[model samples]
Target: MVSSFRHHRRGFFSTLLLLLAVAGCATFVSNISVDVIRHPSNPSSSLPAFHEAPAFRNGDECSSSSATGRVDIVMTLDANYLRGTMAAILSILQHTSCPKSVTFHFLAARPEPEVLANICTAFPYLDF
Candidate 1:
């Protein structure tokens, strides 16, 4: 019974990883900050409002430059799930030893300027 449970858990985790990988990867996004102006668009790609997350800084023990120990994370920038994405990124920054070392790469089906603006506002110091 214990082995069966373990097998099911492993399968569930593997499926989740595969789903994340299938979302597609993206290149580094430039630093572009502007107010998110909502325009009439399809619901799937429509921009959502979000409050800015506090800028996360590295600890005293870590390198001053963000590039010293960088970690790249890739995710789909779907407006429908943008809030969840923000939450996930915020959670990571809050838990990591050197939040400055983390970078984000976002993939979107269509060009979404508002998405970039929103992210830039939400995470001003983010390397994305």
Candidate 2:
């Protein structure tokens, strides 16, 4: 129908606008430090296996925390799906101008130490 086509067109434009905005921010990335990682991948405890990904540095245009606010991402956590989340986080940080300014919050229905510990093994920065 014509109405369905109109809705799809609007959705396409909205997505295109968002992608352009993100790309614009990416262009402002001035310094990229690849040597050091934010959180060390090695977890002390015997946790599930996970490899560490490289960290992303903030662009010069990014404001200091004393001035700018942070972005928090919330996601539900579990064992199975947790294995595949590193790439998604990496992609978000890679596309953003302020990588360190972003924090991830994982909500678990019934929190478990092993699951939490496993997350630590993967992304040791926060209490996931």
Candidate 3:
């Protein structure tokens, strides 16, 4: 029984040492800074123009409404994910029957004027 107790004590100490070593290693992570490249706004004229989407009407009761009758879509925009954001916007416009009625609300971690300009240039008709 004494031998067994000694072996158990040794195992416990080994595990404790291993845990402390791992904890120390984990705490020594270096801080990293990333630089993002800001892109200039592309000319809106270069982009393909899309025709206005037809107005939607409810089955029960509805009348003709303008593009101001919109569906709001909120999204986050950043320079790192600009391409992905543009693709998502394109997909939304393609799939939505009432593209003109769709509005986008972009939120950013930082104030990026270039990002806003790029989005505007890409989607000239976007109401955000």
Local distance difference test, each candidate:
0.77, 0.68, 0.67
Q: Which candidate, 1 or 2, would have the higher lDDT against the true structure?
A: 1
Local lDDT at 89 for model 3: 85
Q: Is candidate 2 or 3 superior in lDDT?
A: 2
Q: Which candidate leads in TM-score?
A: 1
Query: Model 2: which residue pairs collide?
Result: none
Cα misplacement distance, residue 65 of candidate 1 (Å)? 5.8
Task: Give the alpha carbon lDDT tens digit for every residue of 31-112 in model 3.
Answer: 1212122223354432222333333323323224755456899999987787678878888887766666677899999998
Q: After aligning candidate 3 to the native by TM-score, how far in Å is the CA of 111 from where it should be?
A: 0.8
Tens digit of lDDT per residue, candidate 2, span 2-93? Answer: 99999999999999999999987776553233222233344563334657556567899888873466888987777556545655776787
Candidate 3 residues lying further than 4 Å off, grouped into runs, are: 1-63, 66-69
lDDT of 1 by residue, 1-128 (tens): 99999999999999999877665432112212222344334466556566778878778888876567889999899767777888888999999989888888899999878777778888888888
**How close is each model in CA RMSD to the real structure?**
15.1, 15.7, 9.9
Using alpha carbons, what is the TM-score of model 2?
0.53
Q: In terms of TM-score, which candidate is stronger, 1 or 3?
A: 1
Query: In candidate 3, what residue range of length 10 has the lowest lDDT sum?
Result: 30-39
